[model samples]
Target: MARVSQEHLEARRRQIIQGAARCFSRDGFHGTSMQDIFRETGLSAGAVYRYFPGKEAIIAALANEVLTAVRGAFDDALAGPRPAWPDEIIAEALRRVDDVLLFPPALVIQVWSETFRDPRLAGILHGALIGMADAWAKVVASYQENGLMSADVPPAHVARVLLACAQGFLVQRALLGPLEVQVMSDGLRGLMSMGLRRPPEEEPGADAS
Candidate 1:
């Protein structure tokens, strides 16, 4: 038998992954099955099985791919000459996700729901969140260095909040309808501009009377 090159093997895996993504995006995690994947890919059971044992494994692989792309977006923005602001960083990350994922972003909602039932999926997502959070922390630190953000608050805490904002954008887009990146970014910028101010009573020079 002629040996299959590594490139061919990788191509086949990508074919399977892309097919699975279509099925999952259309029918969702519970609705999609291994058989559906085979049909979608036009691959026999044994051929598909050779790459992934079941639908969950395929989903796990897809989730990892999507999350990695998002993280890469953050890394790319931070690697620029100047640190990107919160809105700029998130907008870039969102754009990267839109450009890179073979599946629709809405498919991530299904994956998030499946995480409750599948610890493996949850673990994969959790690890990705930790990595993204660290990247956001760097952004926060940069803001502090430039006197753009408060240095008193822990960067990690602020990072998680910023990460949540990005995740919230995905959730809103998935459920409510399409959302423009600029609209979301503008909202973030507006919120950040409302700098954390102390009340009159708490101001150092305020009169108690």
Candidate 2:
């Protein structure tokens, strides 16, 4: 048999991953089987199995890819000349998620569900979240430096809160049908404006009654 080059091997593995991504996006993780992946990739069982031992492994790879893309979005936004606010960062990340061809945004919902049962998948997601949160913390720290955010708040805590908001947006988009990124951005802006205001109870000269 002719020896396969490393490039050829990597290309074939990518082919399997892309095909599996399509199936998972359409049929979901539990709905998709190895046979579905084989059909999608037009590869025989032996060929597909050579790349991934099972669907869980493929799901893990796809999840990592999606998470990496999200992190890239954060990095890109931060690399700009000016620091981005949370809403701006999220808008860029949403755009990146929309551009991901190998892994659909809806597939992230399936990955989240599977994480509870699969420790490996959970670990991959957990690590990605930590990295992304760290990136967000950098942005938060920048905001504080520029007086856009409070200096008293912990950057890591604020970062995690922003991360949760982004995750919530994803869940809503996946379940609630198509959502406009501008709408989310506007909502975040409104919430941020509200946050900046002093509460009625804290207002100066407010009546005690």
Candidate 3:
């Protein structure tokens, strides 16, 4: 047998994950089975098993992919040049979402739904949420320091709110179809950008209030 290079092994794993995503997207978490993934991938049972010990592993990988993408977006958006307001931060964040995760509305939704049923999945989801919120809390703190974020709200709470809004957008994509996702996403971006701005009652460079 030919030795499989790590690159080849990783590609094979990715291919299996894509297959599992298709199954999960079409049928759903409880509805999908390991055999279904095998059929979807057109890989023999042995081939599928070689990469994933079971369906849970496949679902975990796929779910983590979405989380990882979102985390990268959050980190990148926050680390880049400062936006003028919170909503612009959201706009930039959603742009990354659209650019990276929006091509298949059902896929992301399916991955998210799995968290509801599995404790392991819930852990992964919770970890991603905390990861984003913590990273973003720093961003919020910076805004507060710069007088960009309104002092009326705590930065940590604001960070959690932003993450909740973005996560809600993912749920919307699942509930709505692809066409509506684009429309809803546009609306979501608008909403996300709204409160992060300094109130008109305040001075331009006023101490946070």
Between prediction 1 and prediction 3, the one with superior lDDT is 1
| Lowest summed lDDT window (length 10), candidate 2 | 96-105
Q: Mind giving the per-residue lDDT tens digits that candidate 3 earns over 83-129?
A: 33555555555666565442366666666666778899889888877
Please, what are the lDDT tens digits per residue for candidate 2 over residues 39-83? 999999999988889999988877777787899988887899998
In candidate 2, clashing pairs total 0
- CA shift of 10, model 2, Å: 5.0
Pairs that collide in candidate 1 are none
TM-score of 3: 0.77
TM-score of candidate 2 versus the correct structure, residues matched by position: 0.84
Output the better candidate (2/3) by TM-score: 2
- lDDT of residue 18 for candidate 1: 91
Where does candidate 3 stray beyond 4 Å? 83-104, 107-109, 179-209
What candidate 2 gets wrong by more than 4 Å, as runs, is 1-11, 101-104, 193-195, 203-209
Error of 2 at 205 (Å): 18
Which stretches of candidate 1 lie above 4 Å from their native place? 1-3, 194-196, 200-209
Candidate with the greatest TM-score versus the true structure: 1
